[model samples]
Target: MRILLVGAGLSGAVIGRTLAQAGHDCHVIDSRDHAGGNCHTERDAATGVMMHVYGPHIFHTDDAEVWDYVNRFADFLPFQNRVKTTSRGAVYSLPVNLLTINQFFRRTLRPDEARAFLECQADTSIADPQNFEEQALRFVGPDLYEAFFKGYTEKQWGCDPRNLPASILRRLPVRFNYDDNYFFHRFQGMPREGYTAMIRAILDHPGIATDLNTPYDPAMAGQYDHVFWSGPLDGFFGYRLGRLGYRTLDFERFDYDGDYQGCAVMNYGDREVPYTRITEHKHFSPWETHERSVCYREFSRAAGPDDIPYYPIRLVREKALLEDYVRLAQATPGVTFVGRLGTYRYLDMDVTIREALDTGRDFLARAAQGRSPAAFVHAPL
Candidate 1:
């Protein structure tokens, strides 16, 4: 079988490798000059520091299969994400942990004391929360919400919290304990070399051929038995219906003599601050020592035509537009949509890999049975 895979990100690389290993000819293409999509990383020429060109991507997952799968391609260094945020004038721990709560209030409270204090502070008036603001008010109350989430949410999403969905805030936890590890996953680490190298290893199968800097042409689909598209859902159809909403990031890069910021990531919760967060690239790979450091200040805004789409804005309007694309995708034959952009959802590295693996296995199974697979392995709508 000849398979056409678009977008040489994790999804494309994983699927291409899986199909190639099964003796199928796979051709993977990416518009960018390099593979690994948003997870692309390379060493800085001047400083010799491993720089996460897009942003810092800390691999953390509870799935043992996904953990084992990535380890087969590249060596992973144990890494734990400890995020920090600055609100008003003081820096504090993220995820609203016990230390953060105590530091913000200027009080030393134990776990139980902190829990009870937060309960008292919570607004009892709101029985059922409607949006992000209401959820925060009901759980953490106005004072903590304003100090920690309000300004930050406004800056990050470029919208009022009241208009956003509550599910977004629900993803974050308000812990009563002092543990500040950003993610509660069994496996948390980063590739020692870089994501690009790991993906290159994945695509190195004998049956796989790769072409970078090649744009997708719909007519090419006729040449292959199957097509797996990991590009933007709207883009595949030439945006005939309308463009889906997405928030893209702009990074302002600067090099420093020594460590610029002590930590890897620092979020500015105050709306007055222009950039949302500052990431010291050298801190991402602490095992490597470098005299000079590289850092980026990230600014998020609405994605334009030429801008690279980062975060999908799945608000009311965008959701409706996505549904139209989903219907068109379902009607299209010999094509299957996969990954974050294809599904129009915010997915972590693990989920993307897991889904790709499953999609590839399903395709092989269907081929053996002499049957055509559905348009999507995981439904976008």
Candidate 2:
């Protein structure tokens, strides 16, 4: 079987490698010049500092199979992301932990008192929260919500929190403990050689051919026995239902001697501020020490035609638009939509790889029985 894998990201790479190893000729293509997609990393030519070109991606997952699978390609050093935030000229621990609560209120409340106080603070009227702002108010209260989430959420999504869905704020947690590990994933680490090396290893099979800076054409569908697409679902159909909502980021780079932000990520939650988060890339690689640190101030906005899409805005309107694309995808045969862009949801690198592995295995199983691979490995929209 000749397999055409679109987008050389983790999903595409995993699928291509799996099919190739199964004695199928696999051809992988990516619009970007690199293989890792948004997870691509490289060393700065001048300072030798490691750089995450699209943004910082910390590989963390609880799935043992996914963790071990990635470790086979590159060594991963244990890393716990301790995030921080600044608002109204004050700095606080992120994820709204015990330390943050104590510092923000200027009182050392015990765990019991803190819990009671928060319950009192939360808005009871917002029983059925509709949007991000309402959800924040119900979960945390006006002061904290305004200081921590309102502005930051608006900046991140390029819209008012009231207009955004409640689901967007659901991922954020208000911890009762002092632990500030950021993620609850069992396995959390940074790849020793960066993500690019890990992806390159995944697609290094002799039977897999990767063509960087190559675009996928609908006309080429007849040339391949099967296709695994990781590109934008709407893009596959030429945006017939209009481009689904996406948030893109712009990174402004800077260099400073010693630590810049004293942490990997620092959120500025004040509405007056333009950029949402400041990422000190040097902090990501704790193993290597550089006297001069490199940083990026991230500005999030609606994704334009030429911009790289980062976050998906799964609002009501976009969901409807996505449904139209999914219907079209179901009708279109010989192509399988996989990964974040194809499925129209945000996914960590670990989940993407795990799904790709499962997709590839299923594809091989279907082929062995003389059946066409699915139009979607996982449900889209």
Candidate 3:
């Protein structure tokens, strides 16, 4: 079978590799000059530090299979994401941990005491929290919400927390203990070399042919047996209905002689701060040391026509539009929608890899059984 894999990110690379290994001729194409999509990384010519060009992407997953699969390509150094935030001229541990709670309130409270204290602070008026604001108020009360989440959420999504979904706040943790680790996943690390190198290795199979800086043309789909699209779902259909909403990022680069921020990531909780967070590239790879450091201050905003889409703002309007695209995708033949942009969801690296693997396996199995595969292995809707 001749398979065309669009977008040479993890999704396309993994799927292409799998199908190629199964004796299928796989052709991968990416509009960008490089592979790894948003997870693209390169070394700074000046500092010799591995720079996460787009933004910081820490590979944290609990799936053992996914962990082992990535390890086969590149060595992953043990890295924990310990994030800090600045609010009202004070610095505090992120995720609103026990230490953050104690420091913010200027009191020493034990686990039980802290839990009770937060409960007291929590608003009991709202029995059913509908939006992000209400969820934050109900979970951690007014003070903590305003200090940690409100401004940050507004800047990150470019909208008031009241307008956002409650599920967004659910992803953030408010620990009663002093554990400052951002993610609670079993496997957490950054690739020793970089994400691009790992992806390049994945696409190095004998049966796979890669074409960088090449955009997908509808005509090319006719030549292939199947198409696995990892690009934007709306883009595949030419955005006839409307472009789905997305929050894109802008990075402000700066250099420092030595340590900058002294941490991998630092969030600015105050609304006065323009950017969401500042990430030091050197801190991401603590194993290597450099005399100078490179950092980026990330600013989030609504994605324009030319801008790269980052977070999918799946509000009510966007969801309705996405459903229409999904219908079109299902009706369309010889194309399988895969990955974050294809599925029109905000997915982590592990989820993207796992789904891509599943798509590959299902396609091979169905073809062997003399049946056509579905448009989506895992339905976007």
Give every collision pair in model 3.
none
Better of 1 and 2 by lDDT: 1
List lDDT for all candidates, in order: 0.93, 0.90, 0.94
Single out the weakest 10-residue window by summed lDDT for candidate 3: 372-381
The residue-by-residue lDDT of candidate 3 on 1-381, one tens digit each, is: 999999999999999999999999999999999999999999999999999999999999999999999999999999999999989999999888999999999989999999999999999898999999999999899999999999999999998899999999999989999999999999999999999999999999999999999998999998999999999999998988899999999999999999988999999999989999999999999999899999999999999978999999999999998888899999998999999999998999999999988999999999999998889998877
Clashes of each: 0, 0, 0
Assess every candidate by TM-score: 0.99, 0.98, 0.99
lDDT for model 1 comes to 0.93
Candidate 3 runs further than 4 Å off? none
Lowest-scoring 10 consecutive residues by lDDT in candidate 1? 372-381
How does candidate 3 score on lDDT?
Answer: 0.94
Q: What is the full ranking by lDDT, best candidate first?
A: 3, 1, 2
- Candidate 2 Cα misplacement greater than 4 A, ranges: none
